[model samples]
Target chain A: MKWWLIAWREIRWEVFLDRASLLRTAIFVVIPIFFVFGNRGLPGGQAGEATIVALALQSVFFPSLAGVSLIAATFTAEKENGTLVPLLAAPIRDFDIVLGKLIGMVAPVLAACAVTLAAAYALASYRYGAERIAHTLTPQLIYALLVLSLLYLVTTGSVTMIVAARVRSSRAAQQLAGLVIAISAAVFGGLGVVASQLADGWALVAVGVLLVFFDVGALEIARRVWQRGEVIGRI
Target chain B: MIEVRNVTRRFDGVVALADASFEVRPGEIVALLGPNGAGKTTASRIIGGILAPSEGDVLVDGISVRVDPNGVRARCGFVTDQPSLYDRMPLLEYLAFFARLYDVSSPDHRAVELAKLLGLDDVLAKRLGAFSRGMRQKVAIARALVHDPPVLLLDEPATALDPEMAQTLRSFIVSLRARHRAILLTTHDLDEAQRIADRVVVLYKGRVIRIGATSEIRAGGKPSYLLAFAGEASAARDALSRIGIEAQPAASEDGLAALRFATDDPRRTNGAALRALLDAGIEVVTLAAEERSLEDAYLAILAEARQ
Candidate 1:
């Protein structure tokens, strides 16, 4: 019931007004501009697939990574500064607080990711004709990418929440979450290299399946471990 | 009403509270007085439904804390010892935020009312980060009262405030009790406890040593007074002794001598002692009853409990 309160607080105090949060969002914006403009000189058709793959990878990493930072900071900072205890002490349930935090953090990053993807799509359409772009952006591929992006965002957000749940210091939580993401990125990047040896569809299916498993696992872990008393008490 | 029954809290293996119990009824202020680590905050947290007790239960307005904590929390307002608010928000925004959490009908109106009541009207627009400690405390108190809940748990509510502000807070709490709202306030300041609390609950080492009316708790010991003089201390002692009064020479600084006297009735004993001192030519520079009347009783209880 107090999800709205938590979301409003995150927006008012952590998002719209926080300089660090704004700067991180700004950084995401700049990444999309770089991708669109930097790849303008690439040839159309088959060459465009490489650019598309690059854009997909960017979507998987930037927004998800940014989401991790936002979620971890939002939770851990509130815990550290004593604000979380008051909110927890309120009539709102623990799950609602977690849900509100996820929405508050993931919503903005999702919006930014949408803009980045759209800008990349528009630039691709301008260079390559609408027909070529549409053929390349098959419904199946788009669906896969969308599923993958959602999984990445949620997986990162949940993992961050899990880490921040036990961590008492906001800065430490942020650093630890970043470290986990960085390690995951390294493993995924290695997998990306291995996927280059396999067929495109098979690779996408394999990686997407793996990400789905990870997301489910993280969500389950968070569900079983997160308790209002343990979280607030540790803080 | 709030009932904390046999509440005990343990962190790791160390027990913070052991079988602590108390209740706050409508139209009464229960002061949770204790020394450091006496489980005052722990008991307050449990009653507020923030921290769950390890051994027992807390019921707020008939809602069990363990069964429906949110229900218990909804009916109670808590002001923690630390005013940990979002620094990014204005004072008004902070209060309004809590009002919304309580689902108050008109959050803005409720905030303004609380702010005015806590003397925070002037700084409503100022960022909480820029406010002084006393200002932050006012906002915290205002936040606790934002929804006008039936129960309030304030941990050291008057801490870090000037005497005037503290007095204002004391009066406000008294007024709240008059409205039939149950209030449980924790304070190390015995004088503040004596002034505002209808009943005093003394906790020592996670146990409630004493709980009763303020008069009943403070009624244990005879009143004591301290007299500061600028003449021969030995003579003053002799004068008090010759008149069959017992006086102990306390501390002497410069040419002033200080003596302590305790009596069952200070009004009668003080006059006799003063007359005896004056007649003996001991200049009575200052004569006043000692503050912390409740403190004496508290320590005596602690000492007795320890033994």
Candidate 2:
């Protein structure tokens, strides 16, 4: 279908080997590893662990922001540069654009996620110097980080793209996406504070389940909204 | 064939178009002519499946845009005045993007043919941002035509072109007719519309005022003749009216006479005037036939509508 074609084109399927996305993803993950451990010994308190986790979250955050730029840049830049009309007039559906955009957001987001995990692992091993990495490098921890990163991608990227689709300026969309990031960090930070006190796994699972529901719901909403039409009329 | 019936569209609190109706059959080029703020773009957008009309139905090849926008877009090609494209992309890449979007199995053929038609083959690989506006326009046109849709809608497609490029675009439109694509073009350039359109549609305030063949709509040598007499055009007109004619006083220049009459048959009006001059005892020194222009008739219609 034409819709799938748009998604494929948007995924930069042909440009998967491009260095820009790879560099953006790698730099996002590796930079924090540098700042977190400057050839220093490990800290031994609950506060240090929390800070380390928070730093890990930041690594997840910044590179994910790059994905935001890519998503917003796709639509807004197209509008500014005059490619929106031709694409809109193509024999494709609006849902195709939405799906294509969503597909496009995934790779960069996943790359950012990959970089975040590597940075987290590197920072853990360097600061703790072979002690904490051995203890915390469990299957549970890896799965938890993967689940958390996917949740972040869905929660942040969907809201960011919806805002992008509603605005004409690509810069404005990216800037607006910064707000979504702030809001997401606040919500997650609050949830983290609350979940730290929960009695068991059920509570965290409930929230994770809710996040998945919202993520799917957001994609569905995005698909329908874009199908309605573009952000602005043709000039 | 595309049929747009009673299409109306509103934006926020303002009505952009209302009670607009028109149709384009196969192989016809209909120009949607209007001044600024006349909702010409809205009409074109609706036909192109860009916007859903607030009311009425648009059927393209019997497919409704509102009901099946994807289907409608698949069958139509729309070239807006300013096409938004990626600055980093090559022209051919952009064309290929659209061709693939339209589900062209062999996009290379569509891309090559469209580039050739729009004369964009030379710039197919050039970065779009580096190209001039005219070059970009050509690429946009190529993108639209890549799908081989039966219907084409161009909104002031030649707005940024120089005279020669504009002429080439006009001929390109004429070539689309040979492809049997039904086209509806929106433009304020009367000369361009006059030259390229098979039928001209004059729209004002979101409604059609006139729709007919271009020659009929722009019959520059109008059939109205005005003559004025020094004393009274009635006596002169009375004599002139005798030969199946009707004449009225238009004006008096110096001491000579003048009267106005409507006669599509110039031969009949001329013969009647010659006989009337002799019968009225008016000096036969000078007799020149005058004709009203298409511009005059069109302007008068607008003036009357305003009143």
Candidate 3:
């Protein structure tokens, strides 16, 4: 319950109220529309397929990067601003603070992904047709865009939070988060290419299951590492 | 009540705090005085449960910090030197956030009440970034009181405040003491500590070198008196010598010759010294006992510890 309170506060202040975050989310939401328009000249079947892949990659890549940066700032920014001491001094449990920040940082990214997917769908359906777009939006692609994307967000967010807590400054955390994003984009982009070439949705679903395991492991590591003393000492 | 029992903290191989122990009773303020890098903040953080001790423990209202740090934290309110606040958040929301974390029944109500107590009710809707330094500090104090914890840890609460604002904060802290809270204040401002603290704990190199009442620490040396005389220095010296007391020539601004002497028993020796001067026909313009300040005692204590 206290974790929920912390998450809600973070979402309200850091995501919704922060102008820079809003701008990043807005750019992500608008990026997929351009991709949909770019594929407008293809045949109906090919255009529908291209739109799905493009949307999936856009949904996973952009928002996950955003989530990584946001999560990276979670501890380092608080430390830099001198807020971490009072936060650590609070009555809330250490795990709750870490879990709350993880959830809080991931929530906005997921919301932006949802928006980007919806916009891509509407634009692709208008450019081609609803039937073709519906035929291309299979269950496995949905899983890839939503479930797999969520797991990826969790994994990256947890790792970034750990990095944020360990680094001496926010700028250093952001640079490290950029490195995380680069590695993630390479792995995810390779998966997208493999799934596209093999024309196999279940293979991506199998990968999705693997990600669930990775997500749990990352979260466990985050919980065990982030303690009040460790957080305060970095500050 | 807060009892810090032989708490030691180390960073890597170096010791930040070594076997520091002190107690702050309910309704009492114990000032933790130290110089830079003296581990005052480390001790405060350990007591507040933000940092754990390397050894030993701190008990807040009988709750051991090592056993239940969150419970001890629940009973304590820590005010750091900087008013580190969420500048984008409104004052009331900021207070309510902490109140909720502390599990208050009515967070909004408690936030408003604390704002009122700190005379910040009118600016509850304002964002913290828009406030001045003093107002921000008041907001920080209000945030600490949101849960009404019985133990308050204030680390240089009046730091960087103007004279008027510092006086106001000092008055407010005294008022908090009136409510029977155990207050541990770590400050370099010896004057402030002398004015409000009931007991003073001197920490040197992460060790508690001295702990006693404020008056006892200030009166670390024998009581001394300065006698300003209208007569010559030779006459004042001769009078004091006749009384079997040695006096040193002291500076005086009013064109009066001054002689200073220390006495173990001021009540008895002062009267005898005055009688000797009067018998010698020396005109004593002023006979005042020199007051030893906390700063003086602090320096002397540190010097002794260093030696």
The prediction achieving the highest TM-score against the true structure is 3
Q: How good is the docking of model 3, as DockQ?
A: 0.73
- Model 1 CA deviation exceeding 4 Å by range: A40-47, A186-220, A223-226, B91-93, B119-126, B222-247, B250-292
Clashes of each: 0, 16, 0
Per-prediction TM-score? 0.84, 0.83, 0.92
Task: Give the range of the ten consecutive residues with the poorest summed lDDT in model 2 chain B.
Answer: B285-294
lDDT of 3 by residue, B1-307 (tens): 8999999999776788999988999999999999998999999999999889999999999999999999998998999889999988999899999998998999999999988888899998999999998998888788788889999999999998999999999998999899999999999999999999999998988999999999998887788899998888888788889888899999986788899998898888889988999898888888899998999889989999999
Computed on alpha carbons, the lDDT of every model, listed in order, comes to 0.80, 0.73, 0.85
Better of 1 and 3 by TM-score: 3
> Order of all candidates by lDDT, from best down to worst?
3, 1, 2
Please identify which of the two predictions, 2 or 3, would achieve the higher lDDT against the true structure: 3
Q: After superposition, how far is residue B149 of candidate 2 from its true place, in Å?
A: 0.9
State the lDDT at A74 in candidate 1. Answer: 81
Candidate 3 Cα misplacement greater than 4 A, ranges: A43-51, A190-206, A223-225, B231-251, B263-283
Scored by TM against the true chain B, the candidates give 0.79, 0.80, 0.91
DockQ of each: 0.63, 0.50, 0.73
Given the true complex, what DockQ would model 2 score? 0.50
Task: Give candidate 3's TM-score.
Answer: 0.92
